[model samples]
Target: MNARLQPFVLTIAAALLLLGALTYSARAADPEPAEAPRPALTVTVVQPQRMAIPMRIAANGNIAPWQEASVGTEANGLRLAEVRVNVGDSVKRGQVLATFAPETVLAEQAQIKASVAEAEAALAEAAANAQRARDLQTTGALSAQQINQYLTAERTAQARLEAQRAMARAQQLRLGQTRVVAPDNGIISARSATVGAVLPAGQELFRLIRQGRLEWRAEVPATDLGRVKPGQAVEVIGASGSRLAGKVRMVGPTVDVQTRNGLVYVDLASSDEARAGMFARGEIEIGSSQATTLPQSAVNLRDGFHYALRVGPDNKVSQLKLKVGRRLGDRIEVLDGLPADARVVASGGGFLGDGDLVRVVQAANAASAPTPAPAQAAAPAGR
Candidate 1:
């Protein structure tokens, strides 16, 4: 190659290299710069307010029949003839629940009646004889020993009549017991007697729950024993989600040694919706308190510590270390690390991080969330 042509080729090569470098630089400058890290979320602050909050204990339990009865018979040699009551039937005192065959009873009763008649006849004959003996003694026709003998015979006959009367009464009682009767007003829960089935004396035939009254038996922790007392109001939740109100009727005298809990009996309010043995949860209002509270959603639990995001006056977000106190309904008390007038992010706090920029919005009323209605709310009647 010629020398001049070589220099010209090198210059051309250099120009091409410089152009390629410039094109790469322009391409890099065309793209947008990476966005800057956003600040923490801003949230409308809430001023912690003083309010009456209920102190309560939640415990699991079961519904129980207030009074349970196992029905039985006291008359032997009787066979079931008819059942007049069935399960779920309401009964009153003296109401006949069942009838038994009265054949043997009637036979015995008839025989006693015959014996009673015979004794009466014999008594009459002896009395007549005693009168005749006395008249003969007055006339000196009968000796004193003979008259005494006749008087003794008359007294024996009268005594025998009296004994027969007592036997008749016993037979009547046995006959009456052949029919099973309700001892008190109640609802029948079970029936075992069947027609033609022979049952011996003291045989259980039915079960009843007296007066349809029910109670919830809650097992509260021994440590919470101080929070429970008789006559305190409570709320009971059934397995079916039925809510019933009641008053504590009794506190057990002893605690269960194994569970370390005590039994609390709560008499159900006037609703008949509750049934025996249903799983139940009860809340007993132990006391009342006044403190700063926040919605449950506002709090976050991380590494066993409770925290909330608070918006500072500068609209910057900061994580607040919080100590929570007793929970009243859907809100928990903020024990510390929060000022009464600070705005804490409630709904969106869980999804935010420190220093993330967030547009702040006012939180709705905390009372709108799930919380116990105050006692003065005037509970609806009939449960």
Candidate 2:
């Protein structure tokens, strides 16, 4: 029984020895476990460009009428019968904006006409008597004193008729004044007249923006006033995001003592979106200057500051804080923090961290770069 048990133990030992040998061989053939080296990001790099950037002076102010004309009732103490125009109405020169009670003026004019007619009739009779007296004097049938009295009467009647006509003319003028017309082509900005409301002479019925023109009066720093000049091109941006093209009409002759600010008057072209009393911001194009600029896409904003991802010789990215300036179109001025000869990631810097390894390529090649394939299991050691 002991010999049989020994044989079975020997067979089991042999099988275990063969199994251990195979395991050792498989372990020897396996590859080492380690991560493959790959770049953190494939990116396009760009160099700063020296370009001519337009120099502009920024300011803020209100949009207002270029010139305002007051439209008022010329005749006094007349009731506003009809208001033909309202606020925001576009009007032409001599266009009727309001009408007063013309009945009263017309009645006065009629009375004046009657007086003139009566005077004219009296003058005709007096003239005929004066002519007869003169003829009789020459014929020795009339006294000189009587003839002289007739001549004086004719002259007085003539003067009275002229006075009556002048009064009639004045009454007619009043009648015309009952209707208020626009003094110039404009848009009505304010309306004070109402139907049946009696207004006095020179009472404003409407306020018109002369020629429908508008302007931006910007307050600029007094220290920068010398940079502004008349006729310089300006671009005004309103609160509603409306852009208006304008030219500098004039700069204020004096600056405020307390605020140290001056006014720049910019005459803007008419636009439907622009209105009086709207606050706005604008830039005056003073001139152009050479500046180092970069594309906006290449810049990153983080923690309330701007940054650029600059690439090093070793292909590692160094996050650089940037001091940026004016922006025009797709380019932004780099005032500092970036060397002129350094290359930076064109875009996608937001996804990276400092000292990140990246693969740099040309823009044209980057667009056509193929996506990396997924890693696969290593081939079996023997295979």
Highest lDDT among the candidates is held by which one?
2
| Local accuracy of candidate 2 as per-residue lDDT tens digits, 182-288 | 99999999998889998878888899999999989999998899999999988888898878888999998989899899999999987888989999987888887
Mark the regions of model 2 whose C-alpha exceeds 4 Å error after superposition: 1-36, 301-306, 319-322, 353-355, 365-383
Query: Could you tally the backbone clashes for each prediction?
Result: 9, 0
Q: CA lDDT of each candidate?
A: 0.82, 0.86
lDDT score, candidate 2: 0.86
Candidate 1 regions with alpha-carbon error over 4 angstroms: 1-44, 270-273, 301-304, 356-372, 375-383
TM per prediction: 0.78, 0.80
Extract clashing residue pairs from model 1.
Answer: 39-355, 39-356, 39-357, 40-355, 40-356, 41-356, 45-343, 46-343, 48-340
Give residue 236's error in model 1 in angstroms.
Answer: 2.5
The lDDT, on a scale of 0 to 1, for candidate 1 is: 0.82
Q: With candidate 1 superimposed using the best TM-score fit, by how many Å does residue 347's alpha carbon deviate from the native?
A: 2.8
Per-residue error (Å), model 2, residue 137: 3.7
Question: Model 2: which ten-residue window has the lowest total lDDT?
Answer: 374-383
Best by TM-score: 2
